[model samples]
Target: MTMLRTMGADRFNYNVFKKKMSKEPLYPTQECSYKMRIEMLDSYLTNQKTVDVSSYFKPGHLVIVDLRDPSTNASLVIALFKIIVGLFVKQRMETGKVLLLDKAHKYLNSDPCSARFTVSMTSLIRQQQHFGIRTIIPTQEPAVVPDAILDLVFFLVLHCFNFPTWMRNLRRHISVNQDRGESEGG
Candidate 1:
């Protein structure tokens, strides 16, 4: 409202300076390629009671960003997850921090958005030790897991993985048994 209603008058009551100055704009909205996409983020820019992230991300609070809607886009989830993870790392207590991604196979696929998200997650995984962070990703489909993430993962807590072909694909990314399908984490 202030940006649209900005008015400056002189001592003589003359409203002369009223041009939208590009050199010194009233509002500081930046000029970027993804400006439209950035503005589209509801959690980042909203005035209603819908923005509940800031208050929940406090110490000793288990903030769970669960978008259970099956129709939700992967890119949107990736963006929100990235933002939340970044904030969580910055404000985490000295004790440590944990980032759990349940059913990550949905977004850890071969799509462009998924690839970019995989890169971001792989970077986070590499710096986990330095930032006192631990990431736990539980996926029902191991085939969808990216190679970048598989190479960096320290452990794989598989439950009832009784298929031989599953181990064959799993062995391609990380070391595991060939015949009996055993995953001995490196």
Candidate 2:
């Protein structure tokens, strides 16, 4: 038997694999697994300088971006998220489900480097819905979030909030919905 190994091959070599394991059948007879695809992109992007992870979402697969790592730069993650959202818009891939935005207020601050592409969460929420992408934004206070976004979100799940201002602001946008629930945190 002859074996051929190529280091860091970009494209797939089905023939080589077939020759090596002639008795074994391919696992994915229909479509490639979504988890495998996410893993592949995660490995590929972590090594690149400027990661454009938007391409992965073109298929509308469920993806979770963990930004809780202290070493990870929040801004870069936000920029990457913007790229994904932009791709979602460009490709018209709308799943019509809440995207579940965490720490969205971080994008409110000004950052000159990503200014051009740093879109508002409000706009993203509005635009995403057109393509059937709903968003769940958890904010400490309505002050941190713009009135526009507050107005745009179809549902609001309120939790224990301290300040009266947050309640005041929320009242303007709050509408009666059975989906609304409480959270342990604001």
Candidate 3:
């Protein structure tokens, strides 16, 4: 027993272990969640790696929602999103690392289960600023995003203003509410 203890004694350095497991700020400052657009100039370049952007993300660090496979169903994505969001919120409240969800529309959709989760975003709005739960969703067609998620967004970053007529009308309503200093439906 003494020999075994001596052999194992060198492996357990509390200080080093603590530092490795410390729940400190893991991601870079100011680069929270975002939706990025990748434009491939040529058809051959579609599968090529344009840039290595992995440094921005930490390993075992970000919860990724991969719905690229055709077999991946909406129900599964909805369930996963709900779980991931809860985890992200808990981590944000405990630590300070905000999780990023790029192209959230891919994961969250208008399915029945997804709609149920969307309704839960009301509570999320209340704790957004407190827990630093920031989400950046970019879509060419904004109609794909659920209206519940839109209500919680305080800032809007539109790269192009050439919106469809329906979207323009929606923007008009949003602008009116903003001008009156109203929190959407709140």
Candidate 4:
């Protein structure tokens, strides 16, 4: 529907299209595109019921939604995490909420998902003090992680990092140049 203008298609003309297709046949590309969309919808949406995603989230316990599928879309994974984060922020808890994006470079990079997640996370990070939330994201490529996040970060943890090459690269990154000079000596 959003692409109707770009597609040069008239809106509210499904019946017109149907009548035309009845006389003619769909072109090869159109046939393949429709078939692929049907298959994709069936694969993801079949047998799925509308349910609360946050019911599994508890106050004092950590719940991990692990996606082991190699072919899963990064946007889908981030979208699920966004829902989880929103739910977590609303829950009353004794312990402070900590969000860990474990090896998040795989799913949070300079892709279509990156821009939207960056905006959402930037807002969340800016309000972390009020919300008592801490976000820890470990990525080998800090470039993949949005600059807004890196700017708001107060602590940077580098574990077992002994490569001068990486250290040199990190020096150019946000805050590593100031106090981590001895790290590359190892």
lDDT of 3 by residue, 1-186 (tens): 122233223433223332343443435431231111112212322354442122223434654555454544565555545544654554423335554556666545676766665665546765777766665667666766776677666777665645455354456436533443223221
Q: Name the candidate, 2 or 3, with the larger lDDT value.
A: 2
- Candidate 3: segments with Cα more than 4 A from true spot: 1-63, 92-96, 106-110, 176-186
Rank by lDDT (best first): 1, 4, 2, 3
The per-model lDDT (C-alpha) reads: 0.64, 0.53, 0.49, 0.62
TM for every model, in the order presented, reads: 0.64, 0.52, 0.51, 0.61
* Residue 1 error, candidate 1, Å: 22
Deviation in angstroms for 18 in model 1?
27
Task: Give lDDT for model 1.
Answer: 0.64
Task: After superposing candidate 2 on the true structure, give the runs of residues whose Cα lies further than 4 Å from its correct spot.
Answer: 1-61, 68-75, 91-97, 110-119, 175-186
Model 1: weakest 10-residue lDDT segment is 8-17
Order the candidate numbers by TM-score, best to worst.
1, 4, 2, 3
Tens digits of lDDT, candidate 1, 1-186 = 132223211111111211233334333343341244335543353555444344455656687778556544666677656666665666557677778999888888888988887888899899998888899998778777888888887988879776656677777777665454244432
lDDT winner, 1 or 4: 1
In candidate 3, the residue pairs with backbone N, CA or C atoms under 3 Å apart (3 or more residues apart, or in different chains) clash, namely none
Q: Tell me how many residue pairs clash in candidate 3.
A: 0
- Quick one: how many clashes does candidate 1 have? 0
Q: Write the residue-wise lDDT of candidate 4 on 1-186 in tens digits.
A: 222222222222223433354465668886775566546545644444532344555767787767445544566566656655776666667768888878766765566666777788889989987888888888777656766676677888777676666565555545543654565372
Task: Give lDDT for model 3.
Answer: 0.49
